[model samples]
Target: MILSYTNIAIKLALGLISLIIVINITGKGNLAPSSAIDAVQNYVLGGIIGGVIYNNNISILQYLVILMIWICLVLSMRWLKTNSSFFKVAIDGKPVVLISRGKLDTEACRTAGLTAHEVMFKLRSNGIYSIKTVKQAVLEQNGQLIIVKAGEENPRFPLITDGTIQLQALDSIDKTEEWLMEKLKEQDVENISDVFLAEYENGNLNLVKY
Candidate 1:
């Protein structure tokens, strides 16, 4: 009985150390997950530890091997997501425009799987009472609503994120790729890929460079 208890204690300590190592390697996203993949990783890690900790049939070496395999899989997925835009979108969906120019887009709401009542609730939580008062309402990938009130001079959204042009943002602002390129040229920026983030507000362009 004493030997069994000692084994359990050792496993508990090793499990905690493994968790710390994973978190350090993966970054803070595992601590406060913002995407579906991050959340799933957390749940799966918890299950692995929880299920194996109390199982006497599993040796410490076996448990460590399982953790190492899981970590490798997670790292590979993260690498793919970083290098491939298609995989990024597939794993973490892009934001949806739920309201544009004071009009509710039912199709967008449907795509986001949000009902009218839910939309209203989100708006009300953001202190917006009427849909007409919203210049734009963006449903972010993290399931948060970004509200832009009518007549606000602030940029509704980023024209570029992570050095990629956001065509949807251009469309929302009634602009085009050609217009963006010209504007960037005017500001002595020749490469769109050099920009990390670009925002347009009140007929002015703001850029954050890589």
Candidate 2:
């Protein structure tokens, strides 16, 4: 009986060490969920707890098997997040337009599963007393609402990014290679090769050095 107990203890220790490493790799982000899928992950984490606590009955092999399954599920979700926009929406719900053109869309609110009280709370938190001040309100997939006031600064487009001169991007913005070279020269940058990243924002090319 003593021998059996010692073996069980060893298994429990090993299981704990393995679990700690797994949790670390999976990340603390899983702990604070922003979506329904995150809620499901928290629930599924119970299996790890169960396996570790019931080490006498659950073998090390069984623990590994379950953990592998969990890892695969997480990786698959990440893959879907990158590959399919539809799947991304299914796991992390699509953003809903709460207010558009100074008009509140009650249907969008209902679809986002947010109560009127919650919407008001979010707005007030953003220091918006009246909905009229909001030109656009978006309920982001992460359960955060973004409010854009009328006459807000125009969103800037990025061009010539990531150390590579983006000819297409330059063409899209109606800029030529000579213009880019001139901008680079003004920044005291001799060549594009020196730039780790370059982007045109607000009609200016911002360059990052290597």
Predicted structure with the largest TM-score when compared to the true one? 1
Task: Locate the minimum summed-lDDT window of 10 residues in model 1.
Answer: 1-10
Task: Give candidate 1's total backbone clashes.
Answer: 0
Model 2 lDDT tens row, 28-57: 532676677866776786667554654556
CA RMSD, predictions in order: 2.4, 7.7
Q: Can you give the TM-score per candidate against the true fold?
A: 0.87, 0.62
lDDT of each: 0.84, 0.69
> How much is 3 displaced in model 2, in angstroms?
13
Candidate 1, 99-152: lDDT as tens digits: 888899999999999999999999999999999998888998889998878877
Candidate 1 segments whose C-alpha is farther than 4 A from its true place: 1-3, 201-204
